[model samples]
Target: MEYQEAKDKFISTWGSLGTLWGINKAMAQIQALLFISTKPLSMEDIMEDLKISRGNTSMNLRQLMDWGIVTKVLVSGERKEFFTTEKDVQELARVIAKERSRREIKPVIKVLDEVSSIKDDGTEKTKELIKQTKALHNLTQDADAMINKLMDQKQNWLTKSVFKLIK
Candidate 1:
């Protein structure tokens, strides 16, 4: 396939995969574009390439920035804001994992903790609720802890080893 077709296919596939990472298709498309670009792109450039509205592009760009996956880039001698994304695949994965842990896993753990801490009134239902929630809370905490440990060891030998194996 030609460069244009290949690029389009990659952006489309990446957009679909974005849902798995808790982002919208357009958000993912924007990131994909930025990821492959030789330099930063302006909002107008993104919208033109993606055929999306200005509002949609602007909103998704902000959301991407919030996730720490995208950033604003200043171009000298230009007024329009340009944007870029994490270029290193490994670093990008690390950021996404850490953000997902904080935004999604941490909140679930907190709620589970609160629910599990309810007083035991000597009823089977109450006991069962506490038991189940406590189990879930423990499991979630353990998973989160594991993720945190992995994050702490960013770019470590083990991580590189795993990626090398996969590749």
Candidate 2:
């Protein structure tokens, strides 16, 4: 495919994938645009290129900053702010994984800990509920550990030996 077509396809696919993960399409599109650009982009540039409203672009950019994947930059003599994404894919994945774990898994683990700690009321239903919550707690904890290990890995952490260990 041609250059423009390939770029558009990438942005659209990325936005759709993000939507599947419960993120808004506009945010994903903005991220994709920033990632593909060689230099940091101003709000006007992003708005014009993506055809997004000013307010929508502002909100998504703020959210991206909060997620630690995007940053605001000040040019040497320019007044307006520009934005850029963490272009290193490995670092980006590490940040995203940590954020999602904190947002998603941590809460479930906390709730499971609370509910599972309740005294047994002796009813079969209550007993089952407690048992299941404990199981969920264990599973989430394990996932958290795996994510931590994966994030802490260095450049060559994934190897034939790693696959063998998993297998």
- Flag clash pairs in model 2: none
TM-score of each: 0.89, 0.92
**Top-TM-score structure, candidate number:** 2
Number of the top-ranking candidate, with lDDT as the measure: 1
The 10 consecutive residues of candidate 2 with the worst lDDT sum are 154-163
Model 2, 31-147: lDDT tens digits are 999999999999999999999999999999999999999999988898899999999988888888888888887888999999999999899999999999999999989989897
Error of 2 at 101 (Å): 1.2
* lDDT for each residue of candidate 1 in 43-122, tens digit (9 for 90 to 100): 99999999999999999999999999899989999999999999988788789989989989999999999999999999
Off by over 4 Å in 1: 156-167
Q: Model 1: which ten-residue window has the lowest total lDDT?
A: 154-163
Residue 72 miss distance in model 1 (angstroms): 1.4
